[model samples]
Target: MNFRRLLAATAASVIATTGLVACSSDSADTKDTAAAAAGETITVGTTDASKKAWAAFEEEAKKAGFDIKVTNFGDYNTPNQALEAGELDTNNFQHLKFLAEYNNGNGTDLVPIVATEIVPLALFWKDHDSIDGIEGEEIAVPNDSVNLGRAINVLSQAGLLTLKEQGLITPTQLDIDEAKSKVKITPIDAAQTPAAYGEGKPAIINNSFLDRAGIDPTTSVFQDDPASEEAEPYINAFVVRAEDADNEQLHKLAQVWHTDAVQKAVAEDSKGTSVSVERTPEELQAILERLEGQLKK
Candidate 1:
């Protein structure tokens, strides 16, 4: 079978059989025993950059009656692939746009269960103390497609450069009119942004990577909007197989992540690097649809 058809078949199979659960006892003692017996140990895949956030998630999951095991992946692409292959039960490292792009491009059926945090891109410099002082230097940005475009958008938002009329969706270096800035623009891997900043060039680092690299957002020279309408599409979420959307356990897991305690912990631990946002599933669906449309264009 062709790859797209194969993915559709796999997604259908996963959706069809994920709902079956064995009946067990309901008494308090038996319930404890049964819950323990049913205490499924499911693996969740996420980027190493999200370790602190996921640690908060793990604590919250324990309170919500789940024994979730989190496995850290070094990069963004592997987690969903792990989920699709049954190596992981779920993942929570990506925003709606990233997930939609992955599914469309690879023919996967991964789906989101809940919104989690907003990891905004921040512009930082080694020599400069503020955005106004960043002129006449080289700026390092993520060389990858998703982040390279995002870096340009963040730079444009800061009035550091001007983009073509096509807007920020998929901007490139050519889209930038370099004559406007005395600085040179260079693209580097997202992971290397912090080191690049330390070496005297300004870099646009994704929030999670910045957190992992121990850079405080409060000290960043310039930051992307955390609550802007433009950033709504980049809100991170808990993702599962399309078939697992209705699973009671996963629904409960989503509740744990959205609680007051989890939100507070994320805000504190992320040190403003990640912001928690609450939204109805219907609202999130609409936002995801809009982001997906932008990515496709």
Candidate 2:
């Protein structure tokens, strides 16, 4: 099935299992009580690759009077849809780019409330030690649009491929300016990039996937531009429905996430694989615009 259909099915399943309830105003006593109850049992949806990251967040949430229950999804597509359908209170497995694309394509009005991490994408090889030595070698990348485009852009930025003079937010392989590198590019499922690496081929693996494969981000050879204006929008963050952004429980949860305790936990648990970023909404919007411009070009 196509991605949209799969997402619809997933959302249907979640809504079927969890009765959808109307969201009340912030001043409603019932809403406050419901939020408190929800805090005692907030369901967070994410992928297995992000378990460690969320565990740190969960511990911090508990210290802030929340008892969080995390549920793992096998793929990247389901979490936001589940959240919008009321199956999950929030999710933290996606970057702004993916969230924006999901919102645009699926019409889901989810919004990010907190910045969490910068999981650097790494260009890796099993046999070759550097990007220059990968000539004639097979290189694997994510097949999905968002990740695939990111892999291609990273390769382009590394001088491995020349993309058409187009914006960056959603550049594809078709934009590759070829003649820049000699390596053969192959598209593989994002989840399978790690295994492909073990098979002695070069690959671009997402930071979380690298962790799942027991590969350390600190040791990768060709790292993406983590601080580039092009990468800001792609930094992962926490997302909730737009209507719930001002909910008291969510605000409290956001506060706990920004504390030094959570930041330290994220750094220690991810082993410095993921960097935490807590920005005000104004600052985040500015960063997002800058990133969007860089990506668009």
Candidate 3:
């Protein structure tokens, strides 16, 4: 469930469906708003298409004297980059593993301020219904560094392929042991996985794209258990700069997502795909540190 290995260049359309905003200008890349502005508008970046589900939370924040702006994005790459550049006040798209990978690779100190939803990355097939039916087919996997290894792990668990190094958290396409695998592996952008599925072709699709493509990710051919110990690293979170961890409005923004109303919205709206998580800062920080260490190596 640790998708810190490869994160592919998701298509621009993901944002198109999710509703994107004007690109954050370089002029306002870094924020100097260190002081808490009473009732100030707070913009939180995200890739979730159904962010309107949080309208209640936004309203609650407004009543409590803060404006909440949910900024939707397309690619997984841009949110953290934008957050690190100070374009967004915070972001809630990626899991802890993805954030740790971003921090390690990019030298950004974005920290998970609060827990959000934890979805699955399961093997999805369009033309074929089952994994066994596509034994001779070529499967598409992510080429991104953070998700590639995890994608490989999912395929390996399906008994279709073998990695050169087994049990790696961040392996790439080069790690696949072709001699021992039955299916052909094709690497492509993570965004393309859902669209790439076709007759005799398989793709290990992430839930972000699965939801966008209208596929019920919870019913994937195979997927990780959100409550399983193996999946602890994949819990999604609202991330902010280390310096802004104590910002009251940011804390309130994080608090809104954990409410029962928002939780119900995520479940009912996402069709039970987005699993809510509640982990203490100490717990998540420890996990992040461990993941960051693994990524650094």
Candidate 4:
């Protein structure tokens, strides 16, 4: 696979429907202890870079008798399919909206076991230094329907435009109330948003392209609040099959990723652009259900 293309896909690509093969848990173990304490091997999947950041965490899990084997994938589509097919114990790579979209689009019920950080989405002026410097001019955003809606929300929150209250989980550019907006929204491929933003053209960029574009999150003219109510749907998460919801070893794996060490590694890997957050599994499930409803509508 071309690394660059896969990298870009990893950030914003919608996965096509694929056959999922669910795997069976080993029922043959005679150990009376909890599954995690029984020296179980938990397989996980995520983007390529996650494995490196998780290497020490994996080792730590092993010390606690839960051996975690994290596999790497290049694009956003495969991991979840693998998980559904029972190839992986769990995976961490998408926000709630993406996961919900996956379930709705494919009729799968992959569920989040824990919450993770909200990746920052921001608007940067190519020439202007701040939001005030931007006029009611043409602005570029990710054209993908899901991310486009996100860009619209970020822009709306920045007081750049007004967005119609759509019942959809993720809004498209059509949801933008153009009559109440200041700038012309230009939707393009997500890979192009960084360069467009770079030229001082008003551009809303996704976090996936940040490092590749060498754009620092702190330097943006208008950045979304990770802690804000509007951002809750976008918070990333660790997901597993619904069947594994009560699996002791899988829960332990989620705990391993939620630890300070794993968080530190995430910050380091993301260059402090993203931070880890812990949300109640119930809350995450609600968000997923709500998003799923919107998609079905």
Candidate 5:
């Protein structure tokens, strides 16, 4: 099946689990009481607990009348594993594509309960200030599966490269339409992309490393559009075990990231790079399902 059809079919199958319910005030009140009575201290796992926005998020959750303990992991692989092992109640660090790959590879059923935001992948060159200046040259990309595909998409969208005419989801080096492309890609470790940029090679750098590299985010020659429909797979979200998909408290806590204070802090933390997006749980789950299908193929 095509991508949209795949998404529709997958979304339809799980609507009951992920969809929003319109309840009367009385029922909503009952749910709140029940949620309070549970008195569970939610433990949320993340890769970046030091971000000021997370502190703001915690405060907002307190205002909403629940407590959450945020735990930080040093690497990308641990958070989901912790969530799957019941060491964490939820996690908010990964996008749907990453979650899909993890689920497919690990045989886990983690699902996104609420969307956070997409941090656009950008191409930066120390010596060049414009995309046109870097034509017919090599651009470095993250070698990892999750970011390599996104880097290719960013280069393609920036008009520096071309991709094969196919239903390419998470494409690789082989998917490049080399004969029609202007630039070549060099896949490297994500952490080293900044060093590659320092050597004057154009590199698509992940947002996480920008600050440490002292690279100005706004200096990127080109970046993928986070608000675009093609970016659905890149939408970061609060993820939980499939069984907790209906946990009202977790869902509410995830939504609290959108409050004014949290949003402001998040933007500042990202150096104005993080674009806050509001997507329904159903939408996030559908994207995750579609991405998983692509991985299975």
Candidate 6:
């Protein structure tokens, strides 16, 4: 897999229609689980397969007697696209908010098998040491709808801005109460947020871009608390087609992410920014349903 090419793909890449797959029977799911347990290769897709955590996860899965094939994708949409097309059994690379946007936009019903972790969106700046007392300056945020809402929430939490609706799941720039806001928001591509910050203005940089840009995660002025209830929508998870939601072996593979080895590697890879979270499959489905419903409205 060309890691650079995948990373180079913008978050705004076009969403192709993910043709629906028919639901399978419970007995079929049981048989599939049995096959996986008997050493059938489970093809899992992810964007960050090059991360250290993946190597650890593969080792752990081997110990648990599951043959895991981790296929790496370059962009956010392709893995879910592959999963929906039955080309991949499962994929772990996006949060519920992102998944909701994908499903609602493309009319696909991919579901989360288990919760994974949350990496908080953060405010970074080159010239400012604090988020306060800086007024009328343009702060760059990711323009991708899912993350733009998150970035706005981060600024709101820091008292840098106010939202017209207090609990918007996917707020936009028009939702901001600009008259009362301390800083002006400039929407830009997420991958370009770091560059915007380097230009001496505050930018809401996603954790995924911090390392490559040589920005330390610890240097963030303010970040959302991943453990909070408000952060639930952003919890990342291992997603499979809705029909495969109950596949036991796949759920077990998702749980392998929380093992000590995987967690340690994740911490090191994310520089302690990735907060491990656990939510039952039912809870994840409930969250996705709620988000999807709200999105449709």
Q: Which regions of candidate 4 deviate over 4 angstroms?
A: 1-34, 37-39, 50-52, 127-129, 166-168
lDDT for residue 161 in candidate 5, whole number 0-100: 76
Across 1-297, the per-residue lDDT of candidate 1 in tens digits comes to 222222233332321453222322232233233333343575778885354556777887887667878888888899999888777767888888788789778987677778887877888876566888676767899999888877787888888877656455668888888877456679988889899977877888876577678777777788779687767767888887765554445656776877776677677766756777777656776776666677777
* Candidate 6 residue-wise lDDT, 36-90, digit = tens: 5453678899998999999999999898887879999989899988987877888
Better of 1 and 5 by TM-score: 5
Q: What is candidate 3's lDDT per residue for 1-297, written digit by digit as tens? A: 101100011111111221112222331122213223443456778886456556756766666666667777888989988787767778888888888878887887788778886776687776445666677778888888667777777777777878887656776778888888888878899988877864435788876577677776655677666776557678988887665554444666687777667777777766787778888766888888888887778
**TM-score of predicted structure 3:** 0.72
Q: How badly does each model clash, as a count of residue pairs?
A: 1, 9, 14, 5, 0, 1
Clash pairs, candidate 6, are: 6-74
lDDT of 2: 0.69
TM-score of every candidate: 0.76, 0.74, 0.72, 0.84, 0.86, 0.86
Candidate 1, 151: how far from true, in Å?
Answer: 0.7
lDDT scores in order: 0.71, 0.69, 0.69, 0.73, 0.81, 0.81
C-alpha RMSD values across all candidates: 6.8, 7.9, 11.3, 8.5, 7.3, 7.9
TM-score of 4: 0.84
lDDT of 5 by residue, 98-138 (tens): 89889999998898988888898888988677887677899
lDDT tens per residue, model 4, 1-297: 221122222332222232222322333131113343443456778885453467767866776677567788988999989988777778988899899889988989898887768778888775556888575779998988878877888887888877778433567777788898888888899999888877768888876788788887677888778888778778888898775554454566677776777778777777787867788877888888888887788
Q: Give the TM-score of candidate 2.
A: 0.74
- Candidate 2's C-alpha runs over 4 A off are 1-41, 127-138, 180-184, 208-214, 283-297
Stretches of candidate 1 exceeding 4 Å from the true structure: 1-38, 49-52, 127-129, 179-184, 207-214
Residue 76 of model 5 has an lDDT of: 90
